[model samples]
Target: MELRKSGSAVWSPASDWRRGSTVRWLLLSVGLGWISLFDSTLWSQTKEVVLPRGTDVSVMKKDILLFEKILDVKLSHIPNAMLAVVDRTKGVYLKGYGIVLTFLVNINRVVITTPFGERPVGKRQTAEEKRRRIHEIREMLIQALKDNPGSFKQLTPSDAVVIVAHFEDSNELDDAKRHKTIVLKVFKRDLDVYKTNGYEKFKQQVVIDEY
Candidate 1:
């Protein structure tokens, strides 16, 4: 008896299995998208603490006035400053991005005469001097971080920390990136991308602009 050739095998089972897997994957992707949207909305609802410019009204005005007087120049002459906060459960540590004015003081000059001795101090620094001093202070700030490891700790996932990095000029951004470990290592809560505004805008809001 002649046996008829077997008809071509039907791969229906394999095709159906693949189709089922594709459907499941699509559903999973949609579910993840919804979850991501919800998370984004929740994050937006949380309060944000802007820095430097966000200080108390009275304190901001006072600082502007003080800087103007000490610099002996218009607020426009002063470079913009940034502020960052290292948030911990106990308290927050704040640092300003501007130069350390204390180091600019003249140690050689005599400021006051006392019965016991004389107090030597320096006069207010010029804009040029302040600019130069910023680089020096940056090194010291980095060194301090290296020396004091306990001062900075890793941030928890829930922690909301803001790091404000002030650049002396636009070119400094590259330098800051080169030495990010010193300048931005403590900012573990977020990535190194900074949201910044112009010094002119900041001056308009806070500076008196008048002599």
Candidate 2:
């Protein structure tokens, strides 16, 4: 995975999640496009929280790394990949297995027939357009996952949440399920539920199609 220096980097799933609360806050800030305002002092102030008696941090980290590798191979064509680890015993943890971007732009070449002749035109989607499209993509992916139970067959107790982000394509939802890199898919509405209703309620509503 390629790593960038200006707050946008291809973070390994293992190392990214192991940094504790401060890293979580940083990731949240990054997701919200607030990376510029991230406080470095919070790193020193952050404390590691203890897990349950049976939760093995090392094992979890190793599993996450393996999952990252699988996702990297499966979604190699996509430029951005994000993982969310949902533990039945523990809570959900979000990480980036590969390159993930705050902004997405879709550029494509299309044949446009003008008044005189037909020629290929390159079209670039604006940030707002891309954002709306991505939102729809997330919803489609979640619906696809809900419809296919076989996609999540590999998930065990150790494996929790696994998600990836990419532009909306007709074949991508099916391709991800066939690749088996993700266990559960969540959309923006689900995240709202997670924040407002709480984790248990979030899990209950995760698999339900909101479209």
Candidate 3:
């Protein structure tokens, strides 16, 4: 059996929150839009757009690059072709209501091999090791977002910055417990508290929906 290092779970938003939301969150569903992040005339097409006033397009580009680099470090240890795209990094804000930032990552591995194209000879990996690896990756993602909190300040207590890490699942597990993907999400109201509270604190408030 092959082993991977991504935590498995889904995020659940409150019923009232969804019903009361004014912004159209297109990226919440599986089959959603993949709008590229850039300065374009597209923003002018709609009165409601992702980038708000004072949003620096250049800084956002750097943030995307930083996200890619962070993912590379985690997957590079074992030669792997991993993809992390910011296809749907959108935001919506309401003056009195709140703001929301949605980020999606596609962690689909193309090839697994060394820089020299040689598979490393190692012993079988255990479940514990895999969980630990996944946890590290999750933390890196959260930290990266925290570091480059561009318009994240606009988010209020009701607002949130959502990050969804989707891992492509190969049908290698037992038929009784097979999954097509592994999703790990980070949902927090206050970014400042993340540093002092730690992962365990955040996990306490996490609402997970497992299949």
Model 2: which ten-residue window has the lowest total lDDT?
82-91
lDDT of 2 by residue, 33-79 (tens): 65433544455445455544544456555544554444334333333
Root-mean-square deviation (CA) per prediction: 19.5, 28.2, 28.9
Candidate achieving higher lDDT, 1 or 3: 3
The regions of model 2 sitting more than 4 angstroms off are 1-120, 166-211
Summarize candidate 3's per-residue lDDT along 28-113 as a digit string, tens digits. 43224333333344665665656645544465455445555554554454323333332344444434443333343323333346
What candidate 3 gets wrong by more than 4 Å, as runs, is: 1-54, 77-136, 139-159, 168-180, 186-189, 203-211
**Alpha-carbon TM-score of each model against the true structure:** 0.23, 0.27, 0.39
Candidate 1 lDDT, tens digit per residue, 153-204? 3323222222222322212235543222112233322221221333333222
Quantify how close model 1 is to the true structure by its C-alpha RMSD in Å: 19.5
List where candidate 1 sits over 4 angstroms from the true fold.
Answer: 1-119, 122-125, 146-150, 157-186, 189-211
Candidate number of the best TM-score: 3
Output the lDDT of residue 106, model 3. 29
